[model samples]
Target: MNKLFKLVRHLTMSLFAMATLIGTTANAERLLTENFEYELGNLYSQGGWLKYGTQAAGPVQVTNNALTYPDYQDKAVGKAVHLTQVASGEDLMRAVSETAISSGKVYLSALVKVNAVADDQYFLAFIQPTSAGIVDKKTPPENTRLIASKGSVDGKFVFKISRNSATLFESTEEFELGKTYLVVMSYEFKEGTKNDVVQLWVNPAVASTEPKPNAAINSATHTGADMKSFQAIELRQGSSATKVGPEVIVDAIRVGTAWTDLFDVASTEPTMTVTPTVVYDGSAVAIGSSTTFATYAVEYANLENPIDVYLTGANRNQFEVSAETIPAGSGKATITLTYKPQAIGKHTARINFESTVSTLNTGFAATGIAWDPENPPMIVAHSEGLTPFTCKAGEQQKQTITVTTSDLPDYGKAAVKGLSNGAFIISTATLLKNGNTQINITFKPLVPGDYEEVIEFSGIKATTETIRITGTATENGTTEDREGDRLPLDDSKP
Candidate 1:
């Protein structure tokens, strides 16, 4: 006991010094335990030990140093919880093993303090029983028995479960063969309201009667084949069944290993977010790496649900993304996202870049479009899908005419008439030019009829078409007037 105390104090001082040396800087240490392995992690659990159950109500805790449990009673003789009164679902618990072991009589010893009470609740136990076998507080197998009221040890319940069964072939009991148990304080692990899984180690007997040990199951992988121990634990019973009630607190759980006890919850790397917002028209964009780039999955979702866009498609980062880790932190690379316009006129695209790093969020852009109309242009009007225009013609009337045109080579002389036979016309078209002005006309007939006047466009493009003016007027008297710019038809002269 003297040697053990000295050793623990030394280890604690060493660890605290190391922590102090680190100050606020980052550091990494590789240690492995039973349930978890870092593939890559840096998790740390602090303090001395964890008590799976709480220190409240049922399975009530006494001021005694060691937490004791009897099955709750039909009623309480005192506040000390007995097995029966503890209610249906409470189970007493404590941490069984920190790291796994390979071999021996697994000893679960605790400095227990008990009061002068005699009942079935007095048996020392383990919430998570060892693979050897399960021993209920009520039934003590051969070699094991319940000790009566020596409970007041140095004025507190400080007791221990000495050892588990020694030989594998023999009837099994819980703890390991060679290991020792030394619990100094009381603490609790309050992750959840669930009852803890624990194993109880009673007072160990003398050496000569010690059970045999299995070579492989007695130790750790580093020690020998028997060096590895499988210390997996689970609840023997819940708050309800089998008698023991809840409400117990155990602390300072320490197990023996070839090496000193190491507490770690460390992970390899911290998560980060990288946003490369590029404005590229004739330029290039990429997710470059000065080191191995964390392959974060980028999302693009203007169309529907957000989609994943990789570093390869950097130009379009517009959706949700999953982050990838860059382990070594050195080999950087870049991913490029590109977008090119197909047509003109207000081309719009929306993009969003989301990352686990909360700081780099919302990448957006609103750019201007540069469009030039004609180098060798076609000046055709844009497709007006459906246009409404007024026509002097009656509704639902059909008319026909033959039309031809000459592509106008000269503007000063009557030139190409771009209009076709289907073109609309004005009241008159006798091309009359004065100064730089030329006359152009258009008209819509109310109904199909025989009608005529003149059609011309001087110094401009024109098309000639044969018309069947119907009003029953044939070869109607007509005259050409080199006349004034206001020439109306001279029907009176005729």
Candidate 2:
């Protein structure tokens, strides 16, 4: 009797993941919509539903205790099925429909109120055989696609999608307690690499009492093989089958061919929105050097799901994208462009964003300037004669040093190094560019001592220039005794 009980338990759990829905309704076929009005004493086994496990271990039943408040209770259309798994073993309560979805595209709609979620649970549309036996969760049958599921982690609700034994996508939105969510999953599968598509939308029709559903969320083309046919819709829990699992209420389940038939509101076509149609490099790009032109946006309107926009055209190679797969309901994504010229001349390139819905291209302009090897630009400036400072033994005094450059296209970076041992320090160095360039260097004292340093400018087309910095600090004393106590504003003035 003990061995027989374990075999039944394993075989019962393996019955899920099979069966298909076929034949289409001219309008929308309501595949299965159950609002349990009758008692559910043995409903899990008798109502065209085949389940795993006994009533003593666990059972799925309809109850009024699942929803009692006025808000969700009225919308529930009376009693709802409470799905639970109390056994320490695998437990599943699933119904295999007579019809199978033969089409590559289909829609699934369900109204679910999450009472509690422990770890992971399945509210799935998948393709699996109706054979008897138990299948391990780690190694489910081949082509077992979990089209959609509702789960929770760390006290937040989550939507999960799995295909070919791997997770394809998960939603970031968290569900609220006692609130009902109308989840709609729409999918179109195609054979190829990253061609199958999946999308999830929550709460299409907002009841007068409940809040709106989360915006649409979609996944990138799954990286695996295309799913077979839609076989079954299941509400199965994972290892959450223990007594610590969840108490969920499922109602108003529907499957159809068209979005209009499944959802109260009709689906809208996807629209593409691109920002800053033109991109230009602020200054002329040097030949053999690259300059970033602009950072712009590509957005979606009316479409709640995520999709990929393939980039194309002449200058597409010059641009680099951050991410091609825009997340679902993100509404917008960003792209950055860089101009790297090979030859010296004026150039223009058109780059385009192409997706299933729309294609948008923008023209970016760049001017390449060649370097003049013979007459290189030079930095011109007068160095400070000497910098002097007087302060307390541990106090610090700030000094400023400036460098000016003539109009030139070529520029070099400025660097300052101190010669004193932990006595002289460079606080800040700022380079400002107008028609000319001005570099400001500030030095601060660290201790009572005499110090000297040098500022070096290198990498210019012309010869490098070095400026000397000298300072002296003494004990804090009377003002009259400090002759050269402060650093001069402009030492070169005298």
Candidate 3:
């Protein structure tokens, strides 16, 4: 009787083991693995991964395994990988997974962050759908799909999901068993997107449980990386394919079960219908005190047109406080936004803001923010006095965009229209440290006909500055070339 019972127990154990193996195989698809260590090693460690050299490559300062950007705040607007000065390098890995995928499909993802900008172009390679390997050189978009979108014309990063698909997942890239590509790329998005925000979450797996968002938002959660190099991981036999070669790094190499569920996102991210983040300052604008002759207005613009964002401001009524000066400890100027006579108890009114940043004699209008007195105060723009030089019947010259805050009562952000013409190209719109934001308006007449370059500045008020220049196939003229009557207001009045 004892022998029979033992035999039965042995059989049951074998059956259970078989079941466990089958279950394990079934659950093996939802994983992400790699050979690259996640670390901040010097050149000796990080290899191949690109760098968006900020002050330096990061692995910024860390304590207790925490990493943070020390000097990450920048105004450039391009999304790039920030390299802290001391940053020797970073860890980027390729594929390796927990279970073997016979059908050869895998779900892949990674952690992404935007320092002060968005990404231009970034990709991830899932190699040899049948075996484990890496795709070294970048393949063309026709050959590989893009899993992420770069920054748009405005500025910001976006990650959305579609039905059974994600926001920006491409399938052009192949998938190899046990192999994953550790890509280092940045991403951004257009501004004015409704309900837009950014954050980080450590447990990516847990993010899927949240309520269904419009689409699959990759950034639903992201946990910043720990500041140390991850250690190499142990793998099962055959894990290292028959061919083993090349310098590779690995850290915190955790194994996962990768299940291919056909994450269907379009071939590319959307075109970005929103604006950029150039207009959000998170604070009300403060106008400065009015100097005697310098008049104040709810709107002010530069003298030239062609430029959209005119050098303008809000809060007219004429304000009088501590002249124009940045508040102590603040990196930006803190002029008084108080322009209303009723601005009494509040000590100061919360109004007025920079519309156009005039520099290089050009009007750099804010991207998009219509004026609103009640909701969020805004200003209008108009043209200034001086514009670009132009041509006449046979004389030749170029048009320009200049700011004219040199005098008051005649100032507001300058808004130039119809200047995006084929003839006038914007060369430089230099905005010095609170200097004249000049826009070098380069005008090239298309034909031999007489052309009138009307540089109109419009914001709160409207003014038109016209320059007539003739186009000819032959180029013969110097800065001294002239033809029609010259407007003393500007030398380009041909």
Give TM-scores for every candidate, taking all chains together and pairing residue i with residue i: 0.22, 0.38, 0.22
- Model 1 lDDT at residue 348: 32
Tens-digit lDDT track for model 2 on 333-427?
A: 78766666554333445444543332222333333233333334455445554445556656666655555543234444567665665555553
Runs with alpha carbons beyond 4 Å of true place in candidate 3: 26-45, 48-103, 107-109, 116-157, 160-203, 206-494
Cα lDDT for residue 217, candidate 1: 20
Show where candidate 2 strays beyond 4 Å: 1-26, 52-56, 65-78, 85-97, 123-127, 130-155, 206-221, 240-245, 263-494
Candidate 2 C-alpha error for residue 458, in Å: 99
Residue 459 of model 3, lDDT score = 28
Task: Estimate every model's Cα lDDT from 0 to 1.
Answer: 0.28, 0.51, 0.28
Best-fitting candidate, measured by lDDT?
Answer: 2
How many residue pairs clash in all the candidates, one count each?
113, 11, 93
- The prediction achieving the highest TM-score against the true structure is 2
lDDT of 1 by residue, 1-494 (tens): 25796467546646754664565343322222222211221111211122234323333223223232231112222122222233343333324445433332233322222222221232333233344423222221211111222233332222221112221211113322212222211111222322211223243231212232211121121221111233422111123344442122222223322112222222222233335645444211111211111222333212221222232222222212233222323223233433332222222343434332222334444222222222111111111232223233343223222122222222223222424233344433332222232223333334444333333343222233222222222222335456558756978878
